[model samples]
Target: MSLAQPLAELLEAADRPLEDARAMPPGVYTNPEFLSHEIETIFSKEWICVGRSSRLAKTGDYLTYDLAGQPVVVLRGKDGQLRAFSNVCLHRMSTLVEGCGNKRVLVCPYHAWTYDLDGRLRGAPFMTQTTGFCKENYALPPIRCEEWLGWIYITLDKDRPGVAAALGPLEKLIAPYEMENYVECFRETHVWDTNWKVLAENFMESYHLPVCHAATVGGHSRLEEMECPPGLEAFNYHWITKEASLPMGNAHPDNRRLEGRWRKTTALITLYPSHLITLTPGYFWYLSLHPKGTGQVSIVFGGGLSPEFMADPRAEEYVATLKGLLDEVNAEDRGCTEKVFRGLSADAARAGHLSYLERPIHDFMRYIAERTGGYRRAFAVAAE
Candidate 1:
């Protein structure tokens, strides 16, 4: 298929500096074919965050993620190692499991085909009648699974470097928060009509805070204090350091070593492909995106308190308040993005100029151009 003209224009814009950059054209958000190309080139090959390994607290604990037309199970085995396997049953391709829980052995509800925690095929009823079929060779196929800072990430492309190697520079910056010990206090899943990139771009900048989040987070958004540092190979980031407006506004006692503004700062990171996070002194939250199609995305929203906040005697009461606050913010974001998606379909809609504050969006545009085959024209511009 020929590249859409509007998309080509957006690609040209992606090469421009922030002062001259344009918001991506509407066609890129509305075109199903472009979305298909993105899925094949980006999502399928990149390392994407699933959730915390802490979610699977014990051997046999498992969770599932559906992406690129496959349901994958990330399971903790008896050996205490986590492995990801295609969740399709071999006999008839039945989905073996749904949601998550402890399973000593995975049994295919369809034909009684069974596999151990490590995904080794242990039984296949009536397999003895098959001419030459062997159980040893029929184990579920494994997807590449790796972890960093207690977060579980998986990639379908075996040769791609692990998330740790790509994100090495971030380790020291993130260690002070001790996110490894932060427990998931709340999580929710929702489907939105907006394209995945729309949400990804929305979270990377604070430009919309004073208007988009006027009722909640906006009052505390100190534009003068914000900064957009250059993104690393693995992610793009923007920093916002100011007091939170909500009840958990008190500065973290654990933030002692964090410099002047760093003590109050929150790093908003968009891990290339689909992981987006906000790390704050008192709490952290993230949205891991999975594109269901050009116009639909599946979002797994999760957040928790910093260890210092969690250890406080008032943690339980604080948890309820925090969740409530985030729910409101999410509702606001969903409404705005969905409206933008709807507007994109209008004939009059066009790309707008970027703000200096939207440097991370510039980084994201460059990131996509560098990785996707559909943007080869844009890649040439970036190379120059």
Candidate 2:
């Protein structure tokens, strides 16, 4: 792929030494042209997380969302399998479903073309006039889908690796948390008036927590306790090993079995393109970011409790408190990221020096550069 001059330069800057590396250039965040390139190369190819298996626990339960520019539907079939398909009908290409709910079949509102929950065509009205057409030959095209640790992910690019293959050893690192059994207790979707990278990078590091989130979660943040070990082949993560400060004190009696730092700290991870998960001993939360365009992002912001947390007698009451704190934390994040988006496009705005704590952002930039075909250089001697 031929690189744009500005994008090429941004990649070059990203490839520099960590101490000298600045935040990515302003154009990387706000340029519509670059965003288009990302949509085609990165969004279209990555196995993006949409939601969790808990979202569709019963047969016929389904959900629909747009990825890149394509509408996708993932549903639980009658056979107890989860599948993904192009949500457009085979007839005139109208959307097959909207929002999310359990149903017997996916019926196209345009002309009554109906499909089974697994995306098999079940009904098509009066189409015998066409030559050599068979109902079996025209099922909705399957979109690549896979579930990893209870999360459902889909990719538009058939050639890309499945989520498990892409994530590789990171799964073992998180295995101690038993994240697969966790529940999707709550979720809120909204459009943030900021670039997807803005929210993703913001969520990746704690550098701004002391300042932007001071009134919220930042009060407990101790920069000295943080660690950003080198990233992996598929992702980057940092340890926010501060003492737990939740009403439940972040430590669960049942979770005491966990060894060392993990028993008391949170693992904040950015799984490539965009799957952000914050894993604490008691709970886990995620930000599934989908870019609406260069200037906007659609976020599925939500969290869940570990089995340990759910087993507590005060579980019900603590849920409400947890949700409220998350809500406030989300607001603080919104304020900071939106303002940063506005700053990125300013004439005087320039990339600034990065703290050692912002190592994940540096890793994230290398991901952007590689995925967008901006550069072929390696990121830190390759993770393996």
Candidate 3:
């Protein structure tokens, strides 16, 4: 039950001698009980990147998304302030909005209950005469929201530490990028037939580049040339590869010039729990993984860069190039993850193991395990 002991055991058990082979057990991906625990411990407690700050740049701008399983609306109020609120209407639990757009106020389709950008209940039709009806106390529940480097992060748990504290040492690590200047360029959603964790683990390491993504990622950045930085800081790691060829259709205008310029790129920085942030040379993208059930997952991808970058003609081309590369990489990953999901579903008792190169998976699993009462508790009941 001691936190340190389980963490130490997980470190010892999951750690591998080979740098390239480290990974979490395959069982973790396929296990239902473990996945449920993650929803409670990891998703609920973590500070997840919900969207970009620019998404709510103007007053009355809002974006509705499913954070974990809870529907949430990220909005900028009339006062030019940003905040997050449970997207569900307090009256009937109906979702306030289905998507993102400019709205002076959020109006529930079920009964026209209205809420301001700051989540204050602005009006409730006919509720004034009802007993126990207090309009003042009927506001949409607020989620803890913070902006860092242009990314908007939300925590479902109100009592949790501030976003900076949850990010720990990572705050200083990404300080050099000045990420806030970027504007959003692309947004897409890809629903996978696999567990969310399976897709995420794919991003945590570079070992699969040679075999899994040879056509797109592998051809551009060779496995031997790819760098994997050390420690948990490395999980949010970024590396610059010189003269890397941009994928077709997504080429930057400066594609020819990238031969020498230091292009920035980053891997999974768990915006706590199921959200992930990745930065490439031209733009930054965020991935939010929402578990639909034990077997299905919804993945939302949002991309952006500074207004200055978007204004630059060359940067426009760069953004295009990055998108092409992402499409290919994601295509390859989706295929593999779907197959893994099918394989695991076909076998209920199978157990999977981790490799040393997958230290990020270990870090992620350990983080989850600590929050969920250790691996023994997670696995024991299910295995029995």
Q: Which candidate is the best by TM-score?
A: 2
Leading candidate by lDDT: 2
Where does candidate 3 have its weakest 10-residue lDDT segment? 375-384
The residue-by-residue lDDT of candidate 2 on 17-101, one tens digit each, is 7888888888887777888888988888888998889999999898888999899999998999999999999888999888888
**Clashing residue pairs, candidate 1?**
none
Off by over 4 Å in 1: 4-7, 247-250, 254-259, 373-384
The CA lDDT at 200 in model 3 is 73
lDDT of 2 at 114: 86
| Candidate 3 lDDT, 156-273, residue by residue in tens | 8888777666455665555544456657778777688888877776666666766898787665554444454444521334343423454222224543323333443433355436
Q: What is the C-alpha lDDT of each candidate?
A: 0.81, 0.84, 0.65
Clashes of each: 0, 0, 22
Model 3 lDDT on a 0 to 1 scale: 0.65
